[model samples]
Target chain A: MNETIQHLLNHRSIRKFKPHQLDQETIEILVRSAQAASTSSYQQAYAIVGVEEENLKQQLVEVASGQTYVADNSYFFVFCIDYHKHVLAAELASGSVDQTVETTEALIVGAVDAGLAAQNLVVAAESLGYGTVYIGSLRNDAAKVSELLELPSHVVPLFGVAVGIPDQQPGKKPRLPMDAVFHRNTYTDDDTMRQLLSQYEKETSSYYGERTDGRRTEGWVNQMAASMKDPKRTYLRHFLQEKHLSRD
Target chain B: MNETIQHLLNHRSIRKFKPHQLDQETIEILVRSAQAASTSSYQQAYAIVGVEEENLKQQLVEVASGQTYVADNSYFFVFCIDYHKHVLAAELASGSVDQTVETTEALIVGAVDAGLAAQNLVVAAESLGYGTVYIGSLRNDAAKVSELLELPSHVVPLFGVAVGIPDQQPGKKPRLPMDAVFHRNTYTDDDTMRQLLSQYEKETSSYYGERTDGRRTEGWVNQMAASMKDPKRTYLRHFLQEKHLSRD
Candidate 1:
């Protein structure tokens, strides 16, 4: 019932944004709010690259598989899992840095921290009546995005967020019931999953089919199956390795 | 200036929590708020396992290297990157699921979604006058936590959240200046990083030295250097392989 929880619950990805520029002060506040989120042991293993140049934004639009919002939004920030700075910090504090610091766990910490920071930015933006959407398609060609942003070793662009004033209000998307995702002490039994999923399919089917005026008939499961039938972003492992982020 | 952003900016990880259990309705509302967070392509690739049993909490505390907060918190929930349900959904919609669906991108999606969902839960809990802390140390023995939770294939425990009423108010931790984290069109130059980090080290040194009453002389960089000297959680890559989550 409170405004804070209401803002959290009322979130919807905003794709259509008005052609307005965010003031420098507002953008700075958003970044500060992001930094306020909890970091694992305060390593702060993430960085945000805000792109305002029209040329670079256009290139990123192409790199993100033609997400025009990347070019049109008031601000487009690519959030990267950044450990390169920590490596530099270690070297400055100690004589040398350890190679073992590039373990998978370290990589996980960067990615999770990037996520935590980006989500905070989203909530803060929404609270201020600005709209935001995450650009996961940036990973469609992450290397190009990283190259454009001049990312060094131990840093990789994970996703982008486009923020601006809203031009449209999308209907709230329905999520799976709590029984499906919230388990008690342990994972739910298979029988319970089956029942819950069946109900979910029907609910999703209605949402998609009716909302789009029969333009879409597939339910959540079917759409996911189609998407999963083919491989996606298979180059990620090789890319992570190239960036020295996939140490064994 | 708003309550939502104020709640976010005021966040501090609470280790000392009052011994009080959150009511079931409040917990349900928190989980619902978590589900409301944005997901990539509507793929809700996360699940939360609420652990209230004292015995399981004790075991998790041991798994997390005796972080007594895990055992003492009123509620502890293991947040997981879960694609197992998506795999099942794929199977239900189609006759078979593609093994290629378990690519690193898919894993990243799951991990990022888990982070987004968990942050929402934290904010929601905070809105209701609760304190929250993330336990990344759960990954210190992720395999054991998985085994304890009976997690199936393509599912991994990313972290844990300890939530309860606050027993103490810790000073807000200092973060890197916005100049360091929020870059312009591209990442800032090295000279900028060095200058910013020098300032950061001074701030953090004062914070740590003052907080522990001079008992801990190590600044942020020194502590990070010591922790990074040896490999922590080296078994994660192999653990991912065992869970059938390692695909290129």
Candidate 2:
């Protein structure tokens, strides 16, 4: 395999980080790499907010439900679904986009745009010998995050990425089987999917058991079921609507 | 800049592609790279469907509004936000996830998962000297695309990526100014955003004029305003809800 593919295969989330900070030039390179990602319809419907202030990072830590890494990382970035710029563009062109900006399609586009950019940033940071972890816990209290960041209408925080020098080497979590996630021509039938998942559960159970010295032997299916049994972030829809997104 | 960063900066979407099809090994490497992307809560809420059959590719081309490249590319992959495996997992654990899977938060997670994975696949393909273009037009008739792919419940097609040997070297589309997209500590004020956008409009207008030899000189703001004045894909929400996603 090539070095790039090898690097991708070696990815693992690093939670603990050293005290080192990224230089301005490295930060610029990461952000520019993110900007190079593909945007839908050339509507770059996302923004990156860099948080370096101690107080602001602490507030974000609380919003992330006490994830200290939010504040401990060398750098933290909040990826947001930002249509406020589009609103400004509309005003300048003497046009109204109220109807369009509030659609569910718009929300999906923003989320996808933000996600694409964030992944690019993560990849770039990893290539530069930095460790990164996606702080999806920001969604635990997205409204608090939005308020803390002073986000405007049509702008919402989706997630964050914390990058720094690695202080811990985390094991790579095994993913689902190739046959399970990669379908050929069409989606696999339910029976075939179930068989593939059953096979995967055994593999995952072994992985967890070995990793935790037999303390955590639960398989992928059980873990997924437990998490799926309870709804999470139920207020997200209402919050998006309140922010004038996905109102339709 | 590192080689990876330079590669990312040189990205440009290719609409035309050579007739060469990718070998199975290359496809496996690309998909495996995608699977390595981070997933929120390790949900892995997405799947990739490879389209190699000429007939199916033709059907997808029709779904994407007659974009011939959808069929002409060396390979096409439909990235889907898939929770069908989660449903199966719930069944295996004797638990129910219907309530959780229908929530807006679930939809957003799935979209992000799909987008992250798609971006990784794109980056891997480009590193391997392949040209790629994202086909958001698949959403133009998502239902038809879904039906053609035989997708199941809790699975929705977000977008497609057409990858192949380079047949054309397209100019890079200029993105927004760094100040416009990258905020510090908090969202930028409206006045600063307006100024940055005005500056960007001039650059974009000049870009379009030079590219088309003065035939297409519209600025970014005008283009955005015109596209945003009327909503597109009003049927997406209804379609997603019908697929048992984001119903809540």
Candidate 3:
């Protein structure tokens, strides 16, 4: 396999990092690489905020539901789905914000663009031998994160990435088997899903047992059932609405 | 400096592909690399449908608004934000579907996961000297696309990817200046955004003028203004609502 493919296939989320700071040049390269990612209609509907202030990082730790890595990583970046800039740019060209910015499709586009750029940034960091983990829990307290980052309307904090030199190497987590996650021509039916889950349960049960030294025995399904017992981040609907990202 | 970084920085979406088919092994590696992408909370909340049948590809081309590349590529994969499998697995574990499957945050997580996996797949393909482009236009007629693919509820089509051997090399698109998109400590204020837009407008105008042989002259802001005048893909709101993806 080629080096890039090998590097990509070896990806594992790292939550613990050593006390090493990334140089400015490295951060610049990573951000540039992120910008090189394709944007829908060249809208570039995203912006990144790099946080290094000790107090701010500490606050972010709480905002991210006590993910200590938020404060400990060499760098922490919050990727925002930014339509505010596009609004300003459009108004500068014309006299008002484009009507499109108010659509649900625009919201999805912004979020997807942010995801694309963030993944590229993650791969760039990994290629440099730096460890990275995405903090989706950043949404655990989205309003606070936005306030801490001085975000404007039409900009939502989608996720954060903590980048640093690795202090702990997490084992590669198991995914659904290839045939299970990938379908042919059409989506697999319920019968196929049931069969795939039965086999996957066995593999993941063994995987979790090995990783946790038997402290955790719940298979993937059981764990998902427990964690998702209730709806999560339901506030996001109102949050996006307040940001004027929902339907007009 | 590394090959991975260089390859990433050199990305350009290719719409034309040579008449070559990817062997099964290569497709496996690509999907494996995609699965390695970090998902939100191990939700694995995405699925890919590979399409090679001529009739299905032709339908997808129409669904994607006559994007010929959807049919011309060696392999086309539709990436969906899938919670259908999760619902089934959760039901198996707890004897009922979790309430979490119906929230906006859940939808966002699934889309982000799909985007993350798709980007990894693209990078992997690039490393192996292949070209790929994301078909966000897949959302233009998402309901039809889902019906064609037999997608179940809670499994929304996010986008498609057309992968193949490169038949044409498009010039790399320019992005916003680094300081413009990458903020430190907090997001930049309006003044900075205005200044950055001015400079970017000049650069992009020149880019468009050169590429189009001076036939078209809309700068980035003007183009955005024109495109956003009327909301495109307005049907998505109703589609998501019908699919039970939107909040009631």
Candidate 4:
């Protein structure tokens, strides 16, 4: 493998970080790298809010269900599906985008755009000897996050990334089997998918077992089944509508 | 900037590609790199379908509104938000994830997972000297594209990435100004946003004017207003509900 691919494969979410702050120059470079990702139809429908204030970070930690790393990082960035700029541009031209910006299609575009850019930022940070973790729990209270970030209508905070120098090393989580996730000309049939999942369950069960010294041995399927028993962030729909996004 | 950051900042979508097919080993490496990306809650809820058959590629090109590069590339991959494996696992465990898998939150999770993985694949491909472009036009005919791939329920194709050796050089598209897209501590207020956008409009107008030899001189705001005047892919909401995703 090449150096870049090797760097990617070595990725593990770091929850504990040293108290070393990232310089402004490094943050700008990371943001620039994020901007370089491809956008749907050149609609760069996303924004990054850098949360530096200690009080703001504490509020975010609470919103993230007490994930202390949300505050104890060199820097934190909240990625948002922001089309407020489009609204501004439309207003500048004396036009209206309400017919489009409120559609579900636009929401998907913003989400994908933000995701692509955030991944680039994470990869770039890793290359610069930093560690990062994506905080999807930010969506647990999306409205609170938006309020904290003072996001206007048409701008919904999707997730956050905390970047800092690593204070702890974590084992890489085992992913689904390649055959299961990568198909050929068409999707693999159900029988083949079941077989692959069965194989992965055994692999993951062993992984957790060894990692926890037999304290945890649940297989992948069981974990998924348990996790999916209840819906998460069910308020996201209302939040999106309140933000004037995906209302249709 | 570091080598990785420089590589990212130099990105430009290449629509034309040489007639060279990627070997299976190289494709495997790309897929592996994608799998290494972060997934929400370890729910690797996405899949990649590599389309190599000429007939299938032709159909996809049709779905993509005759983007011929969809078929002329070394490899084409459809990134899909897939929860089929979860369904299977739930079935095996005598549990149900219908409540969770059908929620809008799950759709966001899958979309973000797929986007993160796809960006990693693109970045890795570029590092290996391959040019790539994202074909979001696949959403123009989402149902047809799903049928073409024989994708099962609870799986939605988000977009496609076309990868190949570069056959043409293209200039990087100027993105929104950093101040416009990147806010400090909180979302920037409207006056500042407007000022930043005005600055960006001038930069982009000049960019398009110079690139087209003065044939096209529209600014960013004008383009956004025009694009957003009408909704694109209005069928996506119905499509997602039909696929048993985001039904809530």
lDDT of each candidate versus the true structure = 0.86, 0.92, 0.88, 0.93
Give per-candidate clash totals: 0, 0, 0, 0
Q: Score every model by TM-score.
A: 0.97, 0.99, 0.98, 0.99
DockQ of 1: 0.76
lDDT of candidate 4 over B8-55, digit per residue (tens): 999999999999999999999999999999999999999899998999
1 versus 3: better DockQ goes to: 3
Chain A TM-score for model 1, please? 0.97
What is the TM-score of chain A, computed separately for every candidate?
0.97, 0.98, 0.97, 0.99
For this target, which candidate reaches the highest lDDT against the unseen true structure? 4
In model 3, the clashing pairs are: none
Q: After superposition, which runs of candidate 2 have C-alpha atoms over 4 Å from their true positions? A: none
Rank the candidate models, highest lDDT first: 4, 2, 3, 1
Q: Model 4: residues >4 Å from true position, as ranges?
A: none
In the range A7-43, model 3's lDDT, one tens digit per residue, is: 8889999999999888899999999889988889888
Model 2 clash pairs are none
lDDT (C-alpha) at residue A90 in model 1 = 81
Using DockQ, give the best candidate's number: 4
Worst 10 residues of 1 chain A by lDDT: A94-103
Ranking by DockQ: 4, 2, 3, 1
Candidate 3 accuracy as lDDT: 0.88
